[model samples]
Target: MDWDDLRIFLAVARTESLSGAGRRLAMDASTVGRRIARLEAAVGAALFLKTPQGYALTAEGARLVAPSEAAELAATAASEAVRAEAGITGQLRIGAPDGCANYLLPQVARDLCDAHPGLEVQIVALPRVVNLTRREADMAIAVSPPDTGRLMVQRLVDYQLHLAGHRDYLARHPPLRDLADLKGHRMISYIPDMIFDRELDYLSATGMEVAQISSNSVAVQMQAVRAGAGLGIVHDFAIPFAPGLQRILTDRIALRRSFWLIRHADDRASRRLSLLADALAQGIRAEVLRLEGLLGPCPVRGT
Candidate 1:
């Protein structure tokens, strides 16, 4: 019946662990546990089932999530109404690929924090798609949009990638005048079979040799490229950060892709969520343009 109890319950539900929820709420594990127990007593149903992995939500817990979120939103709205000028406040966890998490999201986070000092942002750098259904993140940035789910998808921005190499490697290797010249040289890329997205499986289609150095992570691939591992397709926004990295065959080979901002459909009515989402989209769009522009005009453009 109490909003505080529902708040704690929701935190535990999302984190799937008392300690994690405690950390987020600035309370200790024992306190979170007691609060959850109290919530269960009030509802007359066990909400979480303990497991080796932590707490797994029971069927009743799954059902409680929606109404609990609705209550949380109402409480937040009431709080915001009293402090209308302070801006939206609360923590938000965003799931994104390492490429964006490491390079792009930081910029967005910085801007958002500067604008709204009370806001907190958590970046969950996951190699796989973030599951909104399980509440893996409050929101996610995905390379592809999902057709099935109770979700709201927004096209955040379009970005480009190109085969690139470190200046040191370029100096030692034979000149890369065209795609044909890429055949004999080594490459740094994702493991072909481990490629999670069809969009990421294009290294083979480039007529280049198989990857000599591989990782599932874009951040790792970027590091390998900078360490002179081999040629890798890298985000344009990321290229400027790697001091010696330069696009290879930019005119002949460029991959254009889009980033989508995804949210649970149930959050569609939350004004606080909308505010945060708008800031995220705008910040990402601006930062991508700024970073990519550091290299001057590219032969390709975003769709």
Candidate 2:
């Protein structure tokens, strides 16, 4: 029943590893283990089952998750209420796609930091989905909205992707007049097997079987195309920044993808989250407008 113990338990449950929880909490692994033991003893139940993979929650621990989350929310709300009087101060972690994280989020982070000098922001730019339930990130910019989870999901913006190639590469290769011409050109894209999200399967929409040059990172893929490696699907927002890149088949080949902003349902009540979400949405909207100006509005397609 101690709030501190419940906090420790929640961290361990979310991470499923003592060392992970310890690192997040700034405590050593032994200290985190002892805290978990104390929490289990106080509750008079074995909260976790230790396994080679990590800790698996016991039935009792699973049952406690909801209430623990509620407690955490209430505590956060209380803390935020007090902090509001003095101005917001806390860390906000965002999980974003590589393109957005590298090209977009930095400006957003700067604006957020300038507005609230005490706030800290971290952006994790990875291709994989971030598990909000595990607190991998406070919020995330994802390609698709999650179908199941206690999450607050919203469609942030729709952006375009186009088949792009460097000027030198296009001049060296045969003209790409139609879809069939794609067969003759080298392609750069995400590795088919390494694509973590189905939304990232860009080449498939082009009727291409595979890419000759592949990478898991969109940034890398873009670089490959920029270096005249081959034609690759690049975000419209990113194209303006890369010199000598041209959108190929502008009218024939364009893919529209959406960015969804997601956050843990429990965190919705926190003022910091509310403010951060608003800032993220605004930044994305501005970027989308810029992208639209560069590439024209995304053509509506049937679902």
Candidate 3:
């Protein structure tokens, strides 16, 4: 069977009109009709019944439509498998929460590139989850398991968050001295909607009110902390203090969070992605544990 004609038939079956299918496929109605007719002739069955209103799929057409869709999926899988067998030798785009990429990717990427000379890696620091449906990225490192349907998610490691401030800020403010002092302190916050719950819970428990210095980017927030605008909350590993930054609450008393590696369900077999995913998982696990140990383990559970 002519695959082009079958594709046209599938489009028409989905749209139920030659004109509609043509618009979708960027072809003319006549071209769509001809292709559909050719496909029907090759199949030895009437694929559609043309009525004044529109095209209606014949029983045979309905049956072929689903299998055709499945065939397309199978074809995509086969192509990815072929690429995987060819080895990790192409650009791999990894989308991640800004902090994760900053804290973990540098070493991981260096090692991967050194090990696989042919593989190139691009790390994108995204504020929100990249849309897998749109292929915004080949894979990702995320804080939470992404929407489950049609995604491949791997829980890499769980980590914790700490409230940190500049030593100078504390010195001038006379050191929080007690949780009660945070009530009037300035705070640099990440994206509000995705703010880790422990951040909020800590404030409530401590009888403090946060003054928000809102930032959308994690790198910006870290810089803000160094500039001494306010105390900022960040993953323990990402904070780069310049001899002045100090952990306000020991990790033992801080909020804990988890991280995951993810990829589009369809791109599971992309060779570059597979290698990158494994590298990221190992890199994150090692780095996060090292940082957590340095900062002191969180007293919180399931950390």
RMSD of 2: 3.3
Model 1 regions more than 4 Å off: 297-303
Q: For all candidates, what are the clash counts?
A: 0, 0, 1
Ranking by lDDT: 2, 1, 3
Question: For residue 22, what is the lDDT in candidate 2?
Answer: 91
lDDT digits (tens) for residues 1-303 of candidate 3: 766676677677767798888875779999988887788778899989988878988899889976776665566566667776566676777888777777778777888888778787888887777766535567877777865568888989887667777767776674465555566678776555655433233334334454477666777888888888888766677754344666765523467778878777766655545656887788779977776677543433211
Candidate 3: stretches off by over 4 Å: 1-86, 191-207, 240-242, 251-253, 269-272, 293-303
Q: Ranking by TM-score, best first?
A: 2, 1, 3
lDDT tens digits, residue span 1-303, model 2: 899888888889989999999988888999989988998998899999999999999999999988998999999988988887877688889999898898778877888889889988999998799999899899999999999999999999888888889999989998877788889899999988889889899998677898999999999999999999998989988887788988877677779999999998887778778888998899888977775587554433210
How well is each residue in 110-172 modelled by candidate 1, as lDDT tens digits? 989888889889999988899887677889999999889999999998999988889899888
TM-score per candidate, chains pooled: 0.88, 0.93, 0.66
What is candidate 3's CA lDDT for residue 178? 55
- How far off is residue 153 in model 1, in Å? 0.7
Deviating ranges (above 4 Å) for candidate 2: 291-303
Query: Which is the winner by lDDT between candidate 2 and candidate 3?
Result: 2
Error of 1 at 227 (Å): 1.7
